[model samples]
Target: MSTSVGEAVVGVILAGGMASRMGGGDKPLFTLAGRPMLDSVLERLAPQCSRMVLSANGDPARFANYGLPVVADPVTGFVGPLAGILAGMDWAARELPAAELIATVPGDCPFLPRDLVSRLSEARRAQVADIALAASGGRTHNVVGLWPVALRDHLRQAIVAERLRKVALWTSRYRTVSVPWVEGPIDPFLNVNSPGDLEEAERLARMLES
Candidate 1:
């Protein structure tokens, strides 16, 4: 996927989830307001990155309409977002030679902040951190953060050799920083994990578009 954001960061949308609470379907594809939640995610994220890719683990054809290169988790057996992030890192390293960093977000968060990449990148640079994460309402959204493409090999070893599935655990080894975001009419990092969350997102969508 070719992006024109002029920044050397690739966006990774982690879409590979069981979504058991949503009845085992692609939660990102679920309609939020009148469009797919992933549509809203892409709308907010695309302009902040050099390009984007979808990290998923199913039949990729279902996401063909989104026009992103779908990458499956490098480590299988329901490892979690770290695997997806690794796949994204690998993809960025291989496909986007100029990309030095990757900004990752959960697929279900439709209203993620447009300044996410900028804030994370800025904080990472200022703090001289290896990674930077998003925080809101005093809670860190671990998966929504910036990672260095140069650490892809280390991440791979953590996933493959160490069998690490928890994102926080893996990130703890690095000099990570947090960039807090203020919540307003909507929490920019809100995730639609269940039908109830989807309903809330539906309500927030109208407010966002208004």
Candidate 2:
């Protein structure tokens, strides 16, 4: 197994969302401050993860240029982010045997905090929790959290056999903890779901890079 917090974790970019609100296209491919939003997610996370995978569905060829393994949700239909996360877990087991945990973030969340994995790891370890999640402005970013690969089977059962869909409901079964980040000039976990959200993200991006 990998030794360190960041190195021990595999990053899962949850790009499987159906961007119906953003006019029905891949939100990750949408331009944000002159580049694809996925680029921004990668820039912040690549260094902090031992390996990274894109959790998306329908035509993996669309993301071939990124050179990352793109895994689709094993479940049929767009169940939810939980299925995408499960796909990442299954991928890590087969491809990255050393990865003990997987950290996740929405693909459209271009401003993901640089310290995301480190902080989540620390929180999980310190609290002896099964899962560690990111919270900003008093709200937890459910998809943006660290999950154990050992629980992939249990998670699969939760989704497949139990029909568990909500992240909160699934996480509540464990000793889940949330690490808070101060949201200020820019909410580091901001995501783009609509055109207006994307426009706002442009301004946040300028502020972040400035």
Candidate 3:
């Protein structure tokens, strides 16, 4: 299942989290290096993907300015990222029929490498994997992945039946491959979860800029 550079891939930002540890505010909209985190994610992913959609569970108006379609979890009630992934798959299936894969990244991960989609796609093709996860510093970053759109039905069934909610659990059921990004100054997949993490990300950004 080889994919060309121009082949359509839908990029999805999972922004629906309750951000319980971040004091219940929107994680994606948090400031990092003087810009919204979602802005950074979109800027990095826009060129890698042919089209983009946001998986968020709040008022769509907040993200409407981005001009990308905003989709909510069909299962509702903040059921975690699996719901967001399912919503993304459904969107790709209908809007971008040519999209064979949906590449996802957490909106809170401001430092995601620009080559994320390409690297994951390469891993998927190399291993003939149904899903590709990103790894850095010997740890798996499951949310950052390229998933075959064909898995939509299975995911939907799982979510609807309350069978599969955890992303790692779902990936374990598939032919999964890991794309290694081991040569960066920091973990390219670094996510900002707490205030301390936000400060750390800021520090890393400064170092990268120098």
Candidate 4:
């Protein structure tokens, strides 16, 4: 297993969302530059993580070719990304018992930074915080954060007992830090939410390729 700052780290791609904005169905399956969006994500994240899993529901067969384990939300009713986070923690705890942390990234973001895990680990250590999230262009991407496996129980309590949905709201209750990244022509955190956004991402992809 790969280690981020001497601690084994696992990566989880949050794909459990119902992409109503993009007319539904697997948004990660959508192509970017003739390859699946998940392919881009995997390509960027694979080097940073020892093992990776997809936090997705429904038929796992859809992602069978990727070969990574597909975990459904542990909580029922599509409890949002928090559920995915908790599920990731649970999975890592079970499958990757040696892993000290799990880092999460959105599935639709094809341009996630190469230094994502190391930077977040550095931010978490420097700030002495329980969690560290990515921020770009003065905006924090709550879902794009590093979570400790030890906090899994508390997260479950927050999601189950308190009905927590908003990621920022839940993260607010913890010691969280945001690691900022320099913005260039394209933001590493740029994600595809709509068809227009996908087209824009395609343009950015071409620019990146060139």
- Top model by TM-score, which number? 4
Candidate 2 per-residue lDDT, tens place, 44-148, comes to 898888888999999999998999999999988778999998999999999989888999999998888888888999999899999999999989989999999
User: Residue-wise lDDT of candidate 4 within 10-40, one digit each (tens)?
Assistant: 9999998788998899999999999899999
For model 1, which pairs clash? none
Compute the lDDT of residue 201 as modeled in candidate 1.
84
Clashes of each: 0, 0, 0, 0
Query: How does each model score on TM-score?
Result: 0.96, 0.96, 0.95, 0.97
Q: How accurate is candidate 4 locally (lDDT)?
A: 0.92
What does the lDDT come to for candidate 3? Answer: 0.86
Local distance difference test, each candidate: 0.89, 0.90, 0.86, 0.92
Give the better candidate number (1 or 3) by lDDT: 1
Residue 48 in candidate 4, Cα distance off native in Å:
0.4
Top candidate on lDDT is 4
Misplaced by over 4 Å in model 3 are 1-4
Poorest lDDT segment (10 consecutive residues) of candidate 4 = 1-10
